[model samples]
Target: MKWFEGSVADAISSAQQKRCLFIVFAADEQPASVSTQESWDSDAVGSVASSSVALKVTPGSDSYTQFTQIYPVTIVPTSYMISPLSGGPLEVVQGTASTDELLAKLQSAQEKLTSAGSAMAANTAGAAPAQASAAATAPAPQTASGAAASTTPAAQQPSNEDKIAKARELIAMKRQQRQEEEKQKDLDSELSRRESGKKLQEYKAQQKSREASDRRKEMQREKDEADRAREEIRRKIAEDKAARRQKQSGSAAASASSEPVSATAAAAAAPSVARPPSLPSDMARIQFRFPDGSSLTEDFSSTTQLSVARQFVADRVSDRFPNGFSLCTTYPRQELTFEVDDQTLQELQLSPRSAVLVLPKTTGKQRRGGSGAGAATALSPDSGVWKIIMIPLLLLQAIWQWLTGSAASSSSPSTPAPSGSQAASQPMPQASSSGDAAEARQRRGRGPETGSSFGVSKEGRVNRFKPNDGGDEDDDMGTWNGNSTQQQ
Candidate 1:
């Protein structure tokens, strides 16, 4: 008879595929006794091994551990019939068995298989009414049905000696079984006690951990309270000192007022620059003196745009200039006009600690009233002032550009040419004038509103307005920006 022998996994796979049993023997056992060899050499035992997957690995090997885990082996030579896929034994035989015992066990397994098939067929066919009634009423059977019952021996009357021997053997088996049960019970109690002890230890550890965490939290809370108490005491001390100083100043004021006129004048003449408290330390200190003689002194952060300063002045004054006013710096004394609305105070380079005059815009340029002590309006997409003024200007400018572009396109040559907007953008061919004395004057009078090519004057004359009168007149000699010289 041939047998397969290898690792646990290999034996298992072959057993499952061949539908056979896996039998293993302990290699560490004292060499097989004569009785064990005789049992193994029997025809029945040899046939069993030949018909199944068989393995005999060393006892203490890694494969042995794996094999023991899959199919429990409390004793060896241990034989287990198993399905390889489940990794568990279906039937187990502990210790060496005689040839007849092994053959009987195999026959019993065959009987069980036949019984399971019969039961399955019976379930599929379902029970008849008569059979169901009979089964419910019938008492238990004395022996197994079919072949099992046929093999069973019938009861017999026995001699006294024979009966005594049988009774003694039965008593011995029952006593052994009772001893094993007591030992199992004691082991179970020990395991339960150990489990309870482990739980207690875990519980005590958790309690200690919680206590440590609580102690840390208490310490942190105490420290925070102490710091707050110290801060409160310091604040109270500062307040008390300030109160005493204020009381002393009140008492000394009247006496000092009578004693210092010349001294006061000297102090006032000193170069002590005043500034707003909120100004950053690095910014220039500036004093704005209005035409009304009222002045504002503030520390100015150089980072703030010049427009912010103009808005600051506008916010404080009585005359509400609608178009916004200009800031004229002193010493160099020039009106801050170029890019006035966009320039930064730092970029304009206004002198530190110097004075500037806040002048109201002239009557004709006043667009709206924006003067008050209220907070300055922040710039946004929907700005109140720009919506009123810029929107109309942008619309008009777009219309003019479109009209010019259309006219240029119509007058372009018949051949395919670039779009009028591109053509208009290209520089026109330069032509020298005949040297007219009025040409300079002609250039000045070219108002942005006039229809002309290359910004030349469309009309030599424009309407002029008198300061006193609200009406306009077509004045030939009037300058365009009022800065151009009139030759007449």
Candidate 2:
């Protein structure tokens, strides 16, 4: 069947204008509904529905809801045949029906509409003859009444038109309102979606930050564990070294105690003392102390000969001791000579760690003090006894010079001139001669002095001071005068 394409209200208006039965079919997507739709589409059902205005509505459509307001659809695949004139339901098919059944229903509803129209037309015809007879019998006054009656329908026609116009306006207003509500719903949904997306981004950022922090913490923890492991290893190694040293010391002491006193003494006096066999045979760390107070440390296998250690020291101190040097230990004060150089360092008790002094070898000529001239040149300036004796004499001489200078300055004009005999007897202050100045310079340079009798002389002898028996003025230079203004 061909269904009306307009809205439900329009379809109803069209049905009324055409004086036909209005048919509405409501259904959802179900097997029964599908069967009913197929039946309506058949040629038999379409032929019967041709005399009616047909409308199809689905469950959620606006037309379906509008139709239901007038004639409620209580079941799926429901059909309603409404009489346009009476605006009442003539037939209702509540469920699925075959094509023949739908066509029979359509025919029955159409016949009802036809009968109602015929009844209304017959009643109108009967009233028309009665109205004509009454008009013919009416007097002059009744004519005015009849004229007013004739204008009544014309006046009511505009009222009907106004009511229809109002109804259409209300429908348009409702449609506009529904459109606005849908727009608002769309906007609200869009805002909610954006908000959800923003929250998701924030959560992702927070997750990344937390993961980075966790990774950094893990790396730091691993580094800390590694450091602790290394520290533990170093501590263990130090403890082992200390324990080994203690054990070696204890063994050495026990072996020394077990030997006889005479043997111990002999060993102590020997140039190369035999080491205890209990000592470790590992590498030896030896420190060589030079005569100049500097030291060198070296490592060697304990089984190496002592001559190697001597050669090692010789190479380092070659500039200082060209002749050679000997190594000796300070504790027992034993010397290591060439005779015992072939012995291993372990046999000499120099294993693990030990200190050896470097002594420059002395020649036979040096031991005998050399020739006289050689001995004299070899002697250093007498720094101890000579400085002690000379410092006091130098202070006294300085005091005497200062006093004489002050006295001469003060008595230049007031003192009377001395007679020849008094002048001759008084010793006058004399400037130091060139020879004495030269000797003073030589003494400052730490060299032997030739002229000075008060300090160390050229022959390395300290000259003694004697009273001047002959009263020589030059010889009296060592004596201090008691009187300030006159010589005593």
Candidate 3:
């Protein structure tokens, strides 16, 4: 068998360079005869080819058997490998390949290739530089460097194990660098985003300050305008009040200068003013004087003027007269005067001893009678004439007794007169002359006598009686004469 040794990359090159068959074998304590051609195809030579290995053992038996399998070899595994060296003396082959083994055959081929690679390297390392260059340029399955680098000695070349370890280490270092670059890019992007947010906050704060300043200015402007308007209104109100006060003061001053006195004062001065002169051509002048020194003269008829004068006097006297005072007038001439009680008093306010009531004769019997008659009548009693004479006669007799020397006895006391009416008629001349006279006086004194005295007159006035003219004395003398003649 031709010798060759290398990894899968070298193996394909050697298979072409040496044109040798790569035989495989199993490894065991007792190798068995196994066939490799039946187990592995000739095309199985690449990476991962060393994963197949064969072991020889009988099914259900504790005994070993000949390995029979074929497999491609790339990298060796740590598991058991079986041998196919069985038959006759049970030969223990170490690297020979056989049937009935899979991974064992590929592993035996790898061992042989490895041994050959060691010998080739030894031969090249001991050579002169010229020979080393020729040998290195020669077709070798185990070398990775190009022909120009092959002049280097075998001792200077990297071991297959060492090359693989360094390749793995380089790949891991590249991956670690890529991960660190990615992490740096992520951290930079995060920092940039935070800076952008801080700038946005500053911008918003400045905008708010601008808006607040504008609003405050607007509010202040409105307040100033309102204050101006209020001041204008106050000025107008003050002007109006001053104008009204001036107008009222002017009017009050004008009123004081125009009028001299009050209406009551003017009326009181009327009585002192001179009367207008009367026209002589006018008929029947009437004139009067008022207490206030004012005089009035009316050119009207006397009767009409008298009527007006009477009404004026009644009005003047109404305030002074009391209820009991009466008026009596004994009118004997022209012009009228008022009388109170018995006499004609000039004023009702003062009492006078006597005065005459004079009324115009043209006022006729009507004034002498009518409502004026009461003013002329005297207030007296209602007793008849007979009692009038007898009552005074009895009072005289009583006085005569006291005037005489004898003291009057109580039994012979004089009796009082009867009032206005006599008793019912009876026989006359029953007593003697003196006794009759005494009895007659007693009857008259018993009660009130009736005459005009203290009685109301026919004119509805208070009339007092007066002494008779002559009729009563004649009647009494006739009665006395007839009695004396009858006694003779």
Total backbone collisions for each predicted model: 2, 0, 77
Which candidate tops TM-score? Answer: 2
Candidates 1 and 3: which is better by lDDT? 1
Per-model root-mean-square deviation over C-alphas: 25.9, 21.2, 40.4
TM-score of 2: 0.32
Query: In candidate 1, which residue ranges exceed 4 Å CA deviation?
Result: 1-175, 178-180, 183-191, 194-224, 227-488
TM values, all candidates:
0.23, 0.32, 0.21
Which residue runs of candidate 2 sit more than 4 Å off their true CA positions?
142-146, 152-488
User: Which candidate wins on lDDT?
Assistant: 2
Sorted by TM-score (best first), the order is: 2, 1, 3
Candidate 2 per-residue lDDT, tens place, 236-284, comes to 9999999988997897788678755685576666444345644355989
**C-alpha lDDT of residue 238 in model 1:** 100
Candidate 3: segments with Cα more than 4 A from true spot: 1-178, 249-488
| Superposition error at 247 for model 2 (Å) | 98
Candidate 3 local lDDT, 1-488, one digit each (tens) = 11223333353344435533233232233332223322333344322243332223332222212212212221121122221111111112332333334345445645554555677677666765666677646776455555445555565656777755764564455345535754676688678778888888888898899899989999999999999999999999999999978987796687668767777665455444334455333234434444344544334432233334455444554553332112223333233433322322223211221222312223446646765656423222333444455565555554554432123222233433333433211112132454454445333322112342221111122122223433343333221121123211
